[model samples]
Each structure stands twice: as C-alpha cells, then as structure tokens.
Target: MSLRLNCDLGESFGSWKMGLDEAVMPHIDQANIACGFHAGDPLVMQKTLTLAKQNNVTVGAHPGYPDLVGFGRRSIKASAAEIKAMLQYQIAAMDGMAASQGLTLEYVKPHGAMYNDMMANAEVRSAIMQGIAEYHRPLVLMLQSTPQAEEHLAEAEQAGISLWFEIFADRCYDDDGKLLARTKPGAVHSKEKMLAQVKQLQEQGTVTTVSGHTLNLRADTLCVHGDNMDGVNAIQEIRELIS
Candidate 1:
C-alpha cells in the first residue's frame, strides 16, 4: 500500500513569514499552495510553484476565505454567489502562476475554517463544487473522510471531479471520524504518535479516535500542517516509518 503526503505551503505574505516551507518540501509528495486569499501574495505563490517544480512535487491550490488577519481561520458571513466568485478568483490566480511555470495546477483544497465549514454546510460545499465544475479542467478535491464529507464528495464525483481523501498526521480524531478541536488538550499528537498513526492508517486501514473508537479510513493522502514547529520532524519520522 502507498500513501501521498501533503503540506500547506506558500503561506507567507509580503514581509511576513510562515512555515519552514523549503525544509518541509523535500519530505512531502504534494504541496497545497496558498492562493493569495488567506495567507499568500502573487510573489509568494510564484516562488512556491517554482520550488515545487524544482522538487518535482505535485502542486495544488489552497484557497480560503478573504480573512487575512485571521489567516482564514475565522468564518465569515457571505452569500453563495460571493463565495463562489472568491474561489474562482483564487483558482484563476494560481492557475496563472502554474502556467508560467509550465506546470498544471492539480487540485483544490479549501483551507482552515472554510474547509471545516464546508464539511457540514451544504451551501458552502455547493459553491465550492460549482466553482470547480465551471473550470472545465480536470481537478481533484482534497478533503477529509467523514459523514459530513460525503455530501461534498458526492457532489464532486457527480461533477466528474476527482476526490482525494486526506488524513491528518499530527491531529487527533473524534470517535465520529472528525478531527478533534484544536483547542482541546492532546488534540495534536507528538511526532512518535503521528508516525504510529501513519503506519496504522497505511497498513491497518484504521485510526483510533480520541474517544477510543476505531474507524475504518482510506489513507489516500496524509497532511502535515506548515505552521507547526514539529511538522518537519514529524514528516521525517513518518517518511522513515512508511519507508
């Protein structure tokens, strides 16, 4: 069995810095680049795409809400039309950067709060799906696997878009197959625990949630958060364990 590892990169904006993206790149298979909405600018996006090309990493767009201050971690009130337009703009921007680098943008993954919101909000999910459908290009949707995720996946599948199920390496899970709240104690696992989880997901096809319930999961891809200090170390350990 094989699994793809992904990370959110290209998050720095202007003079601000976030993540040790260069250090993490060598260890990850796919790079989900931020598209100037939540945490990136054109310069950062271009630079990141170039690095991905040099490293031979798969590139995908990471679009989020227009909340730069919250880094798209805060939910905003917006209509479906507005949200769809915002997504379209972000996707187009990344597509332009990818084109310049002679690389095709492979997929789309909503970032932070937008990601969690779409899992349960049908309106948000529909808007995102519709935006992708209108693109007229083959693009995969990277998302978590859960009961709430089914509706979005179904919509994407029906629209002929590919779906990649993602599991977090450094995050805890609830019994219901949802990620544990970040604010909760022990919500994020240590590098050793993360490596074990990767092995369990890849070999046994299951993960034991925080509530002590084991659930079957497809480990198509694993994610490492860019901003976490332990992310690089965790990825290295995961690569060694999986190798």
Candidate 2:
C-alpha cells in the first residue's frame, strides 16, 4: 500500500499560535485542519487553506467538541443526535472556508476527544458515520486502523461513505490495535523507534504492540504530529523514508 503522511494542523486560536504548519505542510501529503470548534479561527482556517493550496496538500476537516478552553481534548457528554448535528455544522463551516480558497475538503477526521470517543464508543462512531452520510458532499472518513477494521469498514459501507484507515507512526498500540493512552508509560515512541516502526510498516505491513505482539494493520495513511521544529525535522525524515 502507498502510505501517505497526514498531520492535524490549523490549531492556532486568535493570537495564540500553534504548530509549525508552514514548515511541515510541504513535507506531508494530507492536512487535517481544525475548524473553529477546537483550535482554529476564521483567519487561521483561511491561512491554513492557503498554505495547503500553495504546497498542493490535500485538506480534510478535523472537527472536535465545541470546547475552546480544553482544546477539545476533554470529552463532553452529549446525545447521538447532538453529536451528529455538531459534526455536520463543523463540516459545513470547513467546506465553506475551503471553497473560498478554491479548495475542497476531501475527508473528515474527528479531532482530539471526539476521535478517541469515536473509536471506543460504537454509538458515537455510528453517529459520525451517519452525519457524514447525510452531508451534501461525498467525503471519505479517515479513522484509526485496528483489529476491528473489517467491522469499521462494514459500518462505513452501511453509512454509504468511504473509509481511509490510518496508523500512527510514533504512538504505541495495545494488543487490540487501539493506541495506548498517552498517560501510560512508554506510550510514545522515541524517534529511533518511530523510524523503525515506519520501516517495519513499509516492509511487513504490521506494527509491534506494547505487549510485544505483532499486529497486522492495513493502513492507507500514516498520521504524524509536527508541532515544533524538532517535529518538523522528524516529518522531513519520515517524508524521505516514505517517499
């Protein structure tokens, strides 16, 4: 499989700048942009779209819970209908922003707590899928690839949407193929180990889990975070390796 690298970006809110997006955008294939609900403002979203266009990077909506203070990292209690409405609103807003820049959002990847909740909660996952299905534009849904990938594919198929499974290059996974919580010990891999994981994925189409079990995961994309200069450098190295 051809592996495309994706990053969560456009996280700057007002005067608070976040991420080296200009430096990292050129090296990545896909940009999952935040859409105001989490970290982006109107200007930031427009700027990010412009940068993506200049670099010829594919853009996707990265919607999250409507929590600015927590950066959408904290989960909120909401019903399935509320979640669906929230997702559709964010997506429409993003599509509008992209259209203004002569660009189109190709996919949707929920951000932060929403992403984690989607993976762990079937009801939330279904709600998200249903929301995407009801959208005006046909867009792919990018989600984590786990042992339950087949099930996820079935759900997406039922929702009448396409799915792009993604794997994390620098995060450790549990036996069930879910990413280990960041609070856990050794949850994040070192740069050397991250490179090794990328190499293994290129060669074997698998990842070694935290419990030392080899898990087979089919991935169309690889997710990486480039928040700083060091991260930008790592992304450059990853680009070279994957390219």
lDDT of each: 0.86, 0.94
Query: Model 1: residues >4 Å from true position, as ranges?
Result: 147-152
Candidate 1: residue 218 lDDT (0-100): 65
Tens digit per residue, CA lDDT, model 1, 141-170: 888877555665668877677788899988
- Model 2, residue 90: C-alpha shift (Å): 0.9
Model 1: lDDT of residue 149? 52
Residue 2 in candidate 1, Cα distance off native in Å: 1.7
Report the number of the highest-TM-score candidate: 2
lDDT of 2 by residue, 70-171 (tens): 999999988989999999999999899899889989999999999999999999999999999999979999999999999999999999999999999999
lDDT of 2: 0.94
